[model samples]
Target: MPFRSPYPDVEIPDVTLYDLLFTSLTEEDLERPLTIDGSSGAETSYAELRDQVNAIAGALAARGVGQGDVVALHSPNSPAFVATFHGILRAGGTATTVGAMATGKEIATQLEDSGARLLMTVSPLLDAVREAAALVGLADDKIIVLDGADAFESLTDLIAENRPAPEVSVDPSTDLAVLPYSSGTTGRPKGVMLTHRNLVANVAQAAELLGVRRDDNLLAVLPFYHIYGMTVLLNLAILKRASLVTMPRFDLPEFLRIIQDRRCNFVFIAPPIAVALAKHPLVDEFDLSVVSSVFSGGAPLDGEVGGAVARRLGCSVRQGYGMTEMSPVSQLIPAGRDDIPLASVGVTVPNMECMLQDPATREEIPVPESGVSAPGELCCKGPNVMPGYLNNPEATSLTIDDDGWLHTGDIGTVSAEGVVTLIDRLKELIKYKGYQVAPAELESTLLTHELIADAAVIAGYDTEGEEVPKAFVVLQEGAQLTEQEVMDFVAARVAPYKKVRQVVMIEAIPKSASGKILRKELRGA
Candidate 1:
């Protein structure tokens, strides 16, 4: 289907992502006020945000963070972090997001990889940030310290004293805006480079799909470092002029408190948060009658749990799907289709094209016209896709072809109704006795049992070097399910080879900040 934007062809920003917001923000919008909270709330009208952007841009330029230079932010989801991204863009430099939980060694590697000359980190992390900075041999003048280090004063102070950076004309299509990292089957994180045009398009595309209103109150527990939160909630909030409520960490009781307190209408929740809302007892204590919808992403959401949450909240529980390399959104569940199959990830976003392919040959397969079809790889191409992975030519070449299609390593098919149901991952799918099995299927089925709380599935090899399905189960607090009983439960629902031959009851499974289970860790262990 052709994209139907009321503002279609309204012209994406002619500048960088930060510059876009700086120039397009209006005084009227600012007057309504925007609040970003980390330690506490900082209220700014759009006008103030724009003005500060200009000042920071100037300060950065004065300090030599000019065009093409990469500046890395190692801070959490704070106002400074958001401002720094725009500031770098306005100064004609590219901003890079560093995982806040990254170890000093990992931080050093990314800084070295991106050739980052400047780093912004909160005070408490100064020691780690300094060590990383030293590894790259960054100078004092290049560090824009926020809160943690006493080396540089507050960004507000510097911006207040500096003249606005000289505005330079830039073509959005060519200027790199942000660098976020994504890992492939190799489990190595590569920098995903998104240009100004890419980020702007994703934000607009998100607003189109999600349909934000000025009055919508969004609860943002998702980290800004992750593309999902950065694009869908943080950036889109500004684009749509909606109010955003944020928390640093996911605390179930406190999370419920904020929603009940703010009457938050829109929610950008990850899979883990969805799990809590669906099964955690704290959910019953709070009244979420005001929530309008919740978008779950960053990992596979079990269909059964997601639907139940929607019913409990009396709201639409939708899923928006993407990776860091796609400016974060390629498909979103349409508003009125909340009642569609709970497992489906929704249709391709408007202006985006999707195809299923044979993973080995990369051949496109026809979309299924009826019920569940044979699974294939998901491939996508759109303006919202990232240009390339930063400086990793080999990785970029493999991820995006010369023809411009981005190969998603997921295995799934699009149904006739245009709904997408994930079948398996190309890397995680288990081949057992000449048959294919999806770990997610076994995991999802395991989660549905009243006793099971968390589950991860992997392929176990036998003495003959043959593969069999294995499940690692995490039971809810004060609950336990034995291995044989759990295996029998999954065996009854799935095929013979797909049945769990081994079941291990784990206390907990580690997860990334974005809510993806650390499958690689499980395999290594």
Candidate 2:
């Protein structure tokens, strides 16, 4: 009863992630440009990147980081982040990437749970890294700054001192490569164990699906910490031997300027970026004629907005669907394909099976004979799926069934042609500007405020088509607090992206007999 992929299967390379990237490059390709810094106009060639990865790998092995050891990479997207990430994998260690926006406590939690041996970070984020490292009993010597500084051990110095990269054995299928933390179906963040095979398979699947030519130039505005960027944008670009312009952070003007200056041909963006392109006046200030396509993902893109952008830019606008657990890409609209309908996430990638199922009953739903397919929870099965959640067997079992289908918790329908259309999310996590903002995390933060008696968070959309976290609060008796005060309290503690944007005062949060906050009721109100 499952809908199969429309495209023929692709042969996934049976090699480690490190080998998969390096084995395809010819000697001439090694000298080709790899990563270029958008702000500084600096560039790292493929040859240079490979040398740095080798040196860093040797340095990690010399420092006692070996197979199964987790090295925490806590930095914004930069040339060093690329080197350190690959170096960890090459040295038979797993890299646990932490978002730049993570708070000190959040970083500490991941570090503690991951059991990381080394923390690599830029100098600007060293304060948070130091705080988190202290919480988890990490020694000062173990913290390596990617940017060289007089006070701390530097990643460059370590790599330079170790001339020869140490050799290590890795099992592509069993050895952990990257442990990117994700909030599975529910609860606090947990590490998603992605083996070398998983990463390699996803890269292979996306490569054929996206059809990136070797001469293509990519604009990399998305954060490398996120799975979407880490795989599709960064790793995929490298595998295809495409030139990529890297941004430490996204700035509207800077993003546009790089595309114009670098003559980037393709852009991999989120719905928010696409919205800006359609509506922002500054977009007209730069020449974006070189861009041939704009692919949006991480959150749903309004069909009207996508069509508007396509008309304005005179290029193809498409979307893909996946999550952190599915190596983050199960479906994508292949390039140069105009047959798919607007808002469709295109057909499933090669070697992946997708189907819609009743959310409660778990029965597979058949595609309707006429009109759109029935809406149900989308389930996927593929080799690209993660092994499981780190140390959480219950959540893993609940998310991935015995038959290996990963229940995406997204309510959507699949067309007879295998194209998927997403309608709504069954999960409580709010997708604000493409970032997952968990309601539980916000509710816990809100409870810390003495004035708030009870609180519940739900997602709401603004006029711009971006998700906004709206908090409904029950105040203490005779307590007085303005909406701005409530918003400000959360803003100070959490990252800027996760901060509560709107607040509504309520007498009490509606709850069920089992004491669950009825988020739907609050959302309706």
State which candidate has the highest TM-score.
1
Itemize residue pairs with steric clashes in candidate 2: none
10 residues in a row with least lDDT, candidate 2:
511-520
TM-score, candidate number 1 = 0.94
What shift in Å separates residue 508 of candidate 1 from its native position after superposition? 1.9
Query: Tens-digit lDDT track for model 1 on 1-525?
Result: 221222233345455666455456566777865545623555556666667777888888777778788989887766666666677778888888888888787889899988888887777777787788777787776776666346566676657776687667667897788888774334788988888889888886667668778888888788888888888888888777887777777788878888887668888887878877888887888888999888898988888889888888888888867889899887777677755676888777766777778887766677555765556888888778988887778988898888787888888877766677888678888999889888989988988888887888888877898888888888899986789999999889877778999888788877888888788778765
- Cα lDDT computed for each candidate against the true fold: 0.78, 0.83
Q: Global CA lDDT of candidate 1, please?
A: 0.78
RMSD list, candidates in order: 2.6, 9.9
> In candidate 2, what are the lDDT values of residues 34-148, reduced to their tens digit?
9988788788999999889989998889899999999999888888888889999989999999988677888999999999988888888878887888788888888898896
Q: Best by lDDT, which number?
A: 2
| Candidate 1 lDDT score at position 453 | 79
The C-alpha TM-scores of every prediction are 0.94, 0.83
